[model samples]
Target: MSNQLVAEMGVVFIEDSEHHFFNARLAVNGKPFTSLLTPRRIRDFLERNNIVYRCHKGKKQVNEEKQMEINRAVARHLGCLKRPFQDGSPDPEHQYNMDESHFVIDLDDGNPLDFVGAQSVKYRSIVSDRSSGHNNVRAAKGGSNARILCPMLIFKNKKSSYPILNLPDTVYGVYYRSSPSAFINGRLMTEWLQEPRCWGHAWPFTAARTLWMENASGHCESEVEDTARELRTTVRLFPANATEKVQPADRFPIQRIKEHWRRLAERRNIEAIRKGDWKTGSASSGKLANPGKQLFLNLASECIKLENEEKDHNSVDWAKKSMIQ
Candidate 1:
């Protein structure tokens, strides 16, 4: 059949689907319809039947023109931010941005892995009786400078307070707290903003200093603004609906750093399992223990040390690109 005819047929199928046709069995066959029981099933069914469609990689997407507008606005915002440094202090020691990278438990699924070059894959594999039905997580948020501040670690607990982190004198201290869901909330946001190192040290672009952050609900709390004001800092909200484009901490730094985190976590997780060290099991639970906290601080300190020594990559514009791209 010609491609045009197939495309027209595909439109007809879509119209039928809108009317709940996919949910009904075929009139011609009282026997089971081979597949496609819901609107969402249409894509996979069409693919199996040798049909094609253009698909964007992520579920969430914006119109091309809209994204272009967002990019241009971000470029302009970045240009204005650079003006403060242009007067020749050179290093933007006063400007900074921060964001959170949350890691979740993907520990065990019933799925089995096969040897890379094996001729025949075996079916028998270990499956636990206590299989998990839901995933849990904890998040870490950190600020950036030539030296990254100690990551503010959130631990999971239903308590009002957590054990004080006895930070090693060599690196910046880590702030930790507990929450039921382990996600950062208004309380944590307020606490983080209150930290002197967060904004107190940075020189302002205007009469009032503002810290740029994405429009997260927690970050927009009245208390957060109040706390920032108390610290003599202003809270700068990122453009609504523009994520990585306007979020200084969400894009490039995360992309590269997350890759490093994965490599380090994966190797340690596997080695720990072999030696019966259960601390490597969960990203937050076992890993946020005293030893685990030490692990994170040390690893981060090492990376920061290297960043400090690498003069070639430390140009003012490059630093801006690295943190906020």
Candidate 2:
């Protein structure tokens, strides 16, 4: 008999196709669900059982996936910046990598224990936390909390303290802040370019002779192009989709930097909740409370040394192996 006929008759049978006899005891109604034994029979069983399955899509998941696409596009744009100079221009004596980053400061509205359980937000499972339920707003006051502050860091090749130039006549090489206004420009750019005291002697880029920069609107304007001409230096733009491979900031060390920033932010949040240190405005302000700035300098000066030393040791080992072969 066909398997379909056997199932319709509600009788259990075991038989080899080549064998004549079939034998098995069948239960008529004692089963909650049927189990299929054959590996190839899943579709048949599922169709017979009328089962339904569900999939979930979360907001954060969607946002992160979308952001990854955007990152790829941005990386491509940065890669294009590294192309050889088109005009066959001579290489410039100096070059710099420029970028901006954002930081945050938590504001207190008298809510210290504002955390809701993670799983509770999604209907996965319930985790009732008594501490998270407590209204501890009055407990977190006097915190040195305020608006966010952000500062741009410039990494240049070769050791020098050149001031950032301000070019009002032409729009190239203007530095921008998160705010609406330009932070640095014009004579500031010229002076900084000429001055060898500000950003000179920085590692990695400090040793570089040719500078590479992205084509930010402010940097690529005709005036800034003119400025580069006067300086007798060549500017090379990276190819699109290649920043992740070339830019030092996009390289391995950045993850370490972000991890450190997260640690600092968590510590500050704990401190603010425990003591009303800044509510009265007596706590440190401006440059002092800037966690991002502090972390960047510390990593640049000290932690980077450790990383470089390790890289050097690895390089030496690789060279020795190549010689042995």
TM-score of each: 0.52, 0.36
Instruction: Please give, for residues 209-290, the per-residue lDDT of candidate 1 as tens digits.
Output: 4456766787788888887777666566666667666665454454545445444544444444344454334343433122
Q: Which stretches of candidate 1 lie over 4 Å from their true place?
A: 1-93, 105-147, 164-173, 197-208, 278-320, 323-325
lDDT of 2 by residue, 220-285 (tens): 556666655655535555543344444444443344434444444444533433343332234333
RMSD of each: 17.0, 22.1
Which candidate's lDDT is highest? 1
lDDT of model 2 at position 3: 32
**Which of the numbered candidates is closest to the native, going by highest TM-score?**
1
